[model samples]
Target: MGGLNSNAELRRLLEEIGWSPYELARAVNRLVSPDRRIHAKTPFAWRDRGTVPRDPLPAVVAGILTEARGEIVTVDQLWPGQAHKTEVWLPAVAQIAPDRWLPHDTLALLKEFRASGKAKTHFAVSGNELTSLAESWAFGNHALMSNRMTAGQGRITPDYIDYLEKDLAELRRLDDGHGGELVLRAVVNRLAEAIDLLSDSSYPADLGRRLLSLAGQMAQLAGWLGFDLGRHGFAQRMYLLGLRAAVAAGDKQLGALVLSCIAFQQTWRNRPHDAVSIMGTVQQGLRSATTPRVQALIAMREARAFATSGMHSETSAALERAHQALARGQHDHDPAWVYWMGPTVLTSEAGRCYLHLGDTLQAEQQLAEGLANLNQDATRDRVLYGLSLALAHARGTGGRQDLELACYEAGQVLPMLPEVGSARCRNLIDTINAELRPHRATSTVRTFIDKFETMKKAKIC
Candidate 1:
């Protein structure tokens, strides 16, 4: 594997694409942050020998660099031989019949990313040292926690969060074919060990916030699967646990974020009013929180809640608050969690909120802008965004091609459900169908329905 020559390759690719480094930076910045000014520092970090990008960005950089060079750099080229053609990260790596392909395309995607990026470094999941720690903690007495509990090591590093996000993606794939039940059971077992560590461990007192935040995330993940499976009661309970853990961790922001999961769960239950109320809890927490990133998330969730409940005015107001909150985020925020609260997320949330309010024009515009800013590898988020896009097209029922494309993206979650129990995603499918029902005889609409059927058939979630 080459020394993650991302910088060197990026430099070369710039020339190959007839683009200047500043130009590329400007493009990415514009996409990522059209409102708050984008600075040159955002994209130049790719060349820094000592720096590695966060989750979605590294994958985004791989694609962008490859597109400019007119060739694929590949995860292997960037990271190297640690991963294989059959890696589960890729969808094609899984060679099974579509019917029996419980987790079809498990390794199909990793390959695409690998092929697109030049060998930057051999940053395979297998090479992660955190695996051992996670596995060990899984079997440990306190494994019930995931730093989300109340103790143990916290914030291993910014990179650790990225690795964990990758792990979550892998888990999503497995959950598709096998069902979220299997994934939940497995995570529960592993989390038990984490709980043991938290209960028995003693560490720097300052680590408490990190541990609680991580543990809350784990609980939130568990709740998401539960929501997907229609286990409304279970999901709500899990969310409560995660929420409490978040508070104990002294991460009111993360706690509010966890509550957003619950708000989403309520939406899935067809209880939009309940969803609205749940988000209220999130709003209070956000008010007391320090960071704008957390506030953005809280506001976005509130916007979603209001929109789904048919409160057009409230939805717009909440969305405005979401933008205002995001505007407050400076580059100096903690790179780990805060980086996720980028412009893409803000716009996507606003778009989603608007979609539910039946404002197709506003939703369409926000969705387009948000997608342009988003990375391709954030599979879970991408899937939901596609749902929003489909809704945008369905307003007048003429977007057959667009609907079909959205169907393809929805397949990204085939055999695996997202851990972010979002009632809204499923609702989007229903909304699209309702809008197209007047023309169900059309082939494109028919195909879309067929996929929708498949989604519905995913029993037990």
Candidate 2:
């Protein structure tokens, strides 16, 4: 009915594929709208485009034509073969759409584990599976990667981190619908396996480094899931394990990652003092971080801890340090493991710190910059970018418009929700709820509070 597609390539493609323009629109809409059932005439107004659908939709448009004609519609037929391949192939750094193309079964499994955020099932760590995974992780292809990615394994670490990152955002966005419902016995079992392998003295340094980081990563994820599920003891144990593993890897960057990371987890339990304590450790640990970017990481985390404590002075100091460190950038002497600790990362955490300090304006300023600079990797950075935006808006405006904006920012992060264990985010929402209760205007704020409550209740903790 609309002239949006008249005689255009899109319209021609629709005719070529035999799909009604209406049907194509429905599929696109359905993919984006998880809650909405697909229906024709769902409108694909140009004004409505969110993040551009990861590429290949044009090919899908071709495929639609192919499907319509009952013929194999090769993308190559539509575009030249090389051109077709180039068109559909995602950037190595792109977040979704190409998720299915990643080959590492273990990585995908980790992604699934994080996205699920369930840990209610009592984990049993025994038998062949445990020992096998440990052995492989501790002694497996890490050496091969040493030969392969020695040029930059730190670069790769960020990628693995990204896979988990997307899942964390998704977990947060879902609030608590299935927050603590998934079985994590398998993940725990695997971690135990990694622990076994890591403990062996025979492990090579490079392999040990990689395995330890993975172990730390696993522990970090497990702890969050545990928190979500309300298993505080278990969560704490896992965080401790993450700490130990990160240290063993001789990866100060990862240790910094965990130390500051645990600060977020501590904030969830209302342990702002403990959060501050952890941040102190992070600062001390940063002393040894030759990497300027790693120093930024430490500063950002410390700022977060300070903000959670409502210590505006300390928070400001930390935020300033974070920026200064980022300005210093990653020196050549910094370990490859710290490769992703760039300015964009600092901006994200700085935004978060400012938000918690009740400086919503400052928070928004940093957040906008952070989101603008964030690369399209799946790592925690992207999730945090969106999360910082949400928290900033939530605290800044606390109005219906702000709440809706926060929710939308939070939604882009649904796929990576679980890995983000920031008690700050949870507390921020609760704070927003308290602020909104007296207003009695937006049911949406109440709805948000209720949703997070379900998550809290549903979380195994």
Candidate 3:
């Protein structure tokens, strides 16, 4: 973790977490090897001269930052462009004592490792590993909080927290209509503003909890936007921040929601094994959850994870459970977070599951039903479901007639792409194009590609 750059990012990160050079060095030494002591001057040199430490030091420093800031911190952030040499790794060298107090070091390692390159490759996280995390969070005595807040002169009230909550709700609407790319900057700005307010203002304990919960909601929105944009690393970091905020707010529901969101995102990204692992841990974490809608959401995600793994029987069983769970849910009784959940979401997810399981007819039927229920403002989701339907038709044995219908779906999506500013939409379109490449000679396929290309040109112009 050394070499040819400025330490501005390092200094800024350390300052944000209120860690001095000596404290950081001490933390690093304790993390690296308790038997050995590293002088404070070592950190000062590295900080001042960009002298990168060798071996596990980079990962140690990252773990320390993850603990301090309650967010993921990469070696690349502390030492930019060093992944090639460092292997972009999170070392599993340390273990925590089985106490009710979740040690900062252990929490740091969990956050860092979960978002690391290794987690993506080593997708098989065992129940034992996750049980430890659950126990750490469930019985931990240490409070989870961001270091961004300190004493302030201004006063905060319940009304102010309510206003932030309303704003967060509106941001979710914007994401639905315009896609994450168009709304992410606003979400990030709002989150920053909320953190600044928390840092600069004083409030009653109850109001403080409400304000922290509001901040968690904003962080969750930001994380969702990042996931929509395919910035997986950034998305994981935001989710960690959201989880920390939720825990600090004493909002167990929000914490579980964030975990569910992460699992769903991972499932969609084709990491079904990891997704299932996360969902299992989340279930264990929320064993006493009172929200049926949340339970339904979790069940749906589990079904998707099963589908992704080609476990059709398990998928069917999970879907049945999910539908039954949803049937028990009342719209008014659900949280604002689950307001977007309903028949449409269920249908679309079921269709995606069937599509993955190679049931083209069932996929097409469910997808069509979902699309009929979808609103015009949800252009991004509409386009995604349309693509899934088109793909099912393209892969079916129904030949030329089905091909024509598939091309028709492509035509529908092409016209709406400009209105939907999602990276995911573009990626899905590219995937569809790739799937149709073998049939480019077909009249229907040629027509679809030509129209899609023309739309792209129009968008560029």
| lDDT (tens digit, per residue) of candidate 3 on 294-385 | 77887888888788888989899988888888888675556677788787989998999998888888899999999999998888899889
Q: Across residues 220-289, which tens digit of lDDT does each residue of candidate 1 receive?
A: 6676676665554345445544554554455556656665776665555455765676676445434453
Span of ten consecutive residues with least summed lDDT in model 3:
117-126
Best model number under lDDT: 3
| Candidate 2 to truth, TM | 0.48
Candidate scoring better on lDDT of 1 and 2: 1
Between which residue pairs do clashes occur in model 3? 1-52, 2-52
Q: What is the lDDT of candidate 2?
A: 0.52
Residue-pair clashes per prediction, in order, are 57, 32, 2
Consecutive 10-residue window with the lowest summed lDDT within model 1: 121-130
